[model samples]
Target: MQEFAFELALCAHLERPDRVVGRQLGAAVHGRRVADVCLVEPGPEFDRRAAVTPHTIPPLAIESDAGPGTARPVAEAFDCHPDRARAVAERAVELGFFEREREGASTAVRQTVRYPEQWFDSLVGIENKPDLDRPGDLRDQLRIDASLGLFDEVVLATETYVTGAHLNRLPDAVGVWRFDPETGEREVVREPEPLATDGPGIELLDREPGRAEVRPVTAAEKRRQRRRIAERAYGKGWRTYELPDCERCAPSDAEPADLADARLPWCAWTDGLVRPVADCGPTCPGYEPVDGGDSDGDAEGVPPSEGPEAVRARRSAWEPDPAGVDRRQAGLDRFL
Candidate 1:
């Protein structure tokens, strides 16, 4: 629960008009290495990408041979099985990334717009430990991240007072930041060195007492994985939780003055942020039912308004509803 509160506070602080912030994203190319936070800096074609769809454009659709100029049969465009290709195409069309056309008996699809390859500039992966005193596999995680070089920069965010010994334990390329979840203040303990994102990288797969297993990742694979990460971050922002049905939940006053609008799960009874899934329920003494039942304290229910979607749309570069470009024409001869 400490880590959850810290992560939400950090995400609120990191969100801005120029960048998109997401949490708990898969960052590893081979092994399972989930990043606590992913900051996506926008590129020149950011607006174009946003205009396409509010949801993620399936990676398979982007990698297929479909183009805006020519309509290709779904089976011919995708290398996967016919059913999977059709399903992926249908999803892409639903997301406004692809348009369908009737080509004789078979269905053909074409991209509504060219995939914006430069929509995102860079990705920064952050690992949160909050308490360095209980450092569990922190060194191994940082080492894996550095060797993979998937992200342009990697940093460790914590509330612990980092010592010189802690600095020595971390990789040189990994940076450190001291973050205060209560005050919303951050201090950079060390700046991160840039990784070789353009070149090949080594992925640390497994390590035993005597032997270590690794995989050599090519530059092309890294590029594809980077795009997948960006797409996921764009679709899934950091506010992935819902406010519990408790009268004590007050978002307006829970966060700091600057972050009050974030709509975090702040519990008035506890006088601190609370994880609704874990900290909230009938078992909690402060959990007054939202339906206006008997309560120990004077209870006023949570106010009604638009949910986190509206908050995210107002705060970040994401578009909740975009004017899509999936309009289809009546003729197949034009596509041919």
Candidate 2:
């Protein structure tokens, strides 16, 4: 199967229950390393109360020029969308997320939410490899992930059957999983070793044969790293892409007969499951005018609306708490 198809199927399986999963996340500690999939499970501290609920907070307002050194009032920031921003600014004031103060005889409001720090628990990283026959530089990459110890666990998932030779090439700390993309089923062949998130971790600065350089990580440093990663995962949340809002190919329009196996998106034009990334715009050959537009009224090729409100509507697909507010304070205006 294509790697992308495998990844999507694996993602669907990982998100089968209440688990929140992210794709293509950057988890490098010293260098730029991106993980194929990231799974986050909310801890006891994950405040469901902080979840964005209608009328629970005010509409958000922000200065148009949010660049550094641009001092502006929070209220002035909401000038563009006065009605919505005003209500959000008010709620922000009430919830202590925004602090209203006087500066040089003028009132100013600033955000105070520490974010992901107050909302996430643990993060797990997964690397997808559909064909182990072509394992290119997999060793070094897994080695780096294992040494960083940023993730609680690192897993290598592939469709290839497990072999002793494959295990020998990989670090034992990295777990192995046999996955079947067609069925969206996965079995853990090797359990991963838990990484120490609170203690010093080996940082591979330079490694060349006998000459190797590493740095010591303090618990405080680990804490900072964890917060940074959690904050990123909270913001990126999985489901970076969206399905085309095409009525003809929409799940709602699929025939009852085709609804089996979850009916995957069926296209009357193509007479089969539409390509996952197939273009379904008015310009496409398969485009057929439907009586009604997309349920959301947004046309094909148009990405879903972004912002706290949109996220709250699709939170489960985006973050651990699909019911919660967007972790990014900038997108928290949904409550307003």
Candidate 3:
């Protein structure tokens, strides 16, 4: 619960108009390592990428042979099985990344626009350990992140006071930040050194007894994984939680003064930020169910709050909707 609050507060603090921030994203290539938060700094072609779609353009479609010039049969363009290829192509078309055409009996697809290679500048992976004293798997997680070099930089954010011993235990490449979730004040304890993103790196897979399993990730694979991360982040912003249908839920009052407008799930009864799924419902002592039929009654369920999509569109670089490119007419010549 503390970690949840800390993560949300940190995300609110990091969010701005210049970059995009997402939470609980998969950061590893071969292994299953979920980053606490991912900060995506915009590259030179960010505007072009954002104009393509508000949602993620299917990575498979981006990597496939489909181009803007010619419409290729889905089966021919995508290397995957016919069904999977068609499904991915369909999703791409839905997202305005691909334009579909009837090629005789088969379906052909082409990119609405070329995939922007330099859409995102750098990815900063942050691991939130609000309480460093209870540092379960903190060392191992940081080690995997630093060794893999998938992110441009990795940092550990904590509320715990740093000591020489704590710094000594961490990898020199990993940066440290002391963040107070209550006040939204962050102090950088150590600056992170950039990782070798251009070259191959090691990925710690598993460990048992004295032996540890590892894999060597190639540069090409890392590039694909990085793109996947960026797309996922762009599609899934940090405001992933929904407010519970409870009158006591006060999102505006839950966050710090800086983040008062963040619209997090804060229970007035608990007087703290809460995970609506876990901490809410009738089971909770303070859960006052919103009376739907209360036209004049004092009972109020969840207040009419601005949606997360609106908040994200207002606060971040992510576009809620874009005038996407639709090249379906270009493929019409094939019918002629």
lDDT of each: 0.87, 0.60, 0.87
Question: For residues 1-336, what per-residue lDDT tens digits would candidate 1 score against the true structure?
Answer: 389999999999888878899898888888888889999999999999999988889999999999877789998999999999999999999898999987799999999888999999999999999999999989889998899998999999999999999999999999999999888899999999999999999998888899989999999999998999999999999988888888888776665854566778888899888888899999999888886642112212433474778778877899889887746645645636
Worst 10 residues of 2 by lDDT: 59-68
- Runs with alpha carbons beyond 4 Å of true place in candidate 3: 292-304, 329-336
RMSD to the hidden true structure, all candidates: 3.3, 9.3, 3.3
* Model 1 TM-score, 2 decimals: 0.92
- Rank all candidate structures by their TM-score, best first, as comma-separated numbers: 3, 1, 2
Tens-place lDDT per residue, model 2, 40-111, is 776655554235322223323322222123334655666556566656666665654455555576555655
Q: Model 3, residue 85: displacement in angstroms?
A: 1.4
Ranking by lDDT: 3, 1, 2
Instruction: Write down the lDDT that model 2 would get.
Output: 0.60
Q: Which ten residues in a row have the lowest lDDT in candidate 3?
A: 293-302
